[model samples]
Target: MQINTIYTRSVIQTMAGKAIRDLRSGGERELRNVAELCKGCSASPGYQTFWSLLENILRRPDQQYAALLSRAANDVDINCLKTLIANLGLHAYPNGSQPLPGTRESGTSPSYWMEPLDDIMDPRMLHQQISRLQKQGTSSFLFRAGQKPELETILNIAGKHRQCVFFLICGAESCCRAYLEEMTALGNVIPLMEYETLAPTAASLKQAGILFGLHRRYCEIESLQAEENLLRQCIALGCFLGVYEGSAQCPSQNWELACYSRLQEMRCNGAQEIFLADLWRDREAVQKLLEQRSGQV
Candidate 1:
């Protein structure tokens, strides 16, 4: 049943990707229902179009996230916002407990993330990183907890710190069921199913030659009816929900369709604490747009 759910999710994700590729091709033929389909492709549900996504993520915020972060000093405020954080990797801090000292995401200053050690037996680096982030008053931490050791580090850190350690489960391909099971056991380490990486869906679509390939992919899938099962699994396992974001080098269409599908399905399945990676720096605007559109809907 779980395997079938994973396949359906993959196929739906592929459908969205094909839609994005069609829009990006810029041919008039691509406009045949592509624009309409592409509306929810780049951003979350109800974002409506690529323009809507860009306006929210690329443009200035309707409300300042920096101010939001400052005001989110207390535990209540942090909990209200879900204490979201993202992409705090080992490379982010090279010299010391900082993000390589002088880059866009500097280490000397209060950083947005704190990552743990990647090695199975060694979580020392992660501990150091968390300590530094803690000193800077960070309330949240991001970790790629796809593996057992990595998850263990998160649990250890969560036990030691009062902060929220947000776990990004990359994909079912890379993560095992045990990851969620153990994470649920912890009861505090946040379990998050990742979104925002639309490349795989797009690739499947491209390879499947758009709709033609999608149909073929569907034939390979076990069932489509099981799409929402994973969300229920995550929710039942105590997942808080999380997503990734693309860079300026990446396109909005790359993520829209698949994420939109997941977001809608997640909502239908009762996911309430969804969060965007890169923290809210890139997500707040789109989230506001989604809220506004949902209201109108």
Candidate 2:
């Protein structure tokens, strides 16, 4: 399917986490505020990615240090970046990045950005990026759990026009914990929610998208039972079914036919919408699969 799938590999998540830690640990070298760095490199994709890594680190500061929270700013590398904290009299973390001074102890350290695909951008820029990207076609917003105020801020920035964006929030329960009332109040913001209570009226849900639930569990079910379960979930969710690939069974159209008995079986089983999410990685492959799905032979 050409529709984008949510991807959260452990390696990528680990790399991002380590990058944030490395950045934080080196704060003793030099420090520039975030705004100064961003103003110069707003259009630079590399810089945007780097700054994004930092904002992500401070996604949720300590409750005691919460009053001194700096979302759009960071302890920057001043040697390489510009400065604007000169006269504004901002509270600089002169002590550099470290744990909050006083807290209840067994004394565990703080962790940041737990979600596998946690991409917490500054709301202002994220709104613009989303608006721009979705204009080309349908796109997704990966909202991390335990970050509702941030999500709400981004939602307000996105404003009234939210038709094209699909929100794939990890840890739906945790998100509900923080913004349960606010979540129900909104027309958009579809977390990976399964409950009838939280599932927005089907109208509020986007028109056509697939769900990839308990992906690894596919191997556990018997082949016949797997097909049946897939069909059932698609019906219950009112969406397409998406699966990961273990082999080239999809694109080759040999073992798994593109124009043969399996397709007929799928059709007979009332499986109208199914896709291999692994193919979504390649633009050309995704377009070809999309064409196949559309019967554009």
- Top-scoring candidate (lDDT): 1
> Which residue ranges in model 1 land beyond 4 Å of their true spot?
1-110, 113-121, 170-185, 194-244, 251-297
TM-score of every prediction relative to native? 0.35, 0.33
Q: Write the per-residue lDDT of candidate 2 for residues 1-297, one digit (tens) a residue.
A: 112111212222233334334444444222234323433323334334534644543343322111111111122222101111220111111211121222125484322101122465576666666555444332334454455565666456434433322344433432333343333333244345333322343223322211222121222334655555654554355433233333433455443332234433443332333322331233333233222322321
lDDT, candidate 2, residue 89?
A: 11
Q: Would you give me the overall lDDT of model 1?
A: 0.36
Query: For candidate 1, lDDT tens digit of each residue in 1-297?
Result: 135433433444455445444544544355444434434332324344534433343234332222222222211112212222111111111121222222235544323333333343356766676666555434355455556555556667766653344444434332344443434333334433333222233232222221100001111223333534533343233233334333444444534435545544533332333222333333444334433432342
Please give the CA lDDT of all the candidate structures.
Answer: 0.36, 0.33
- Worst window of 10 by summed lDDT in candidate 1: 210-219
Root-mean-square deviation (CA) per prediction: 18.9, 22.3
Which pairs of residues collide in model 2? none
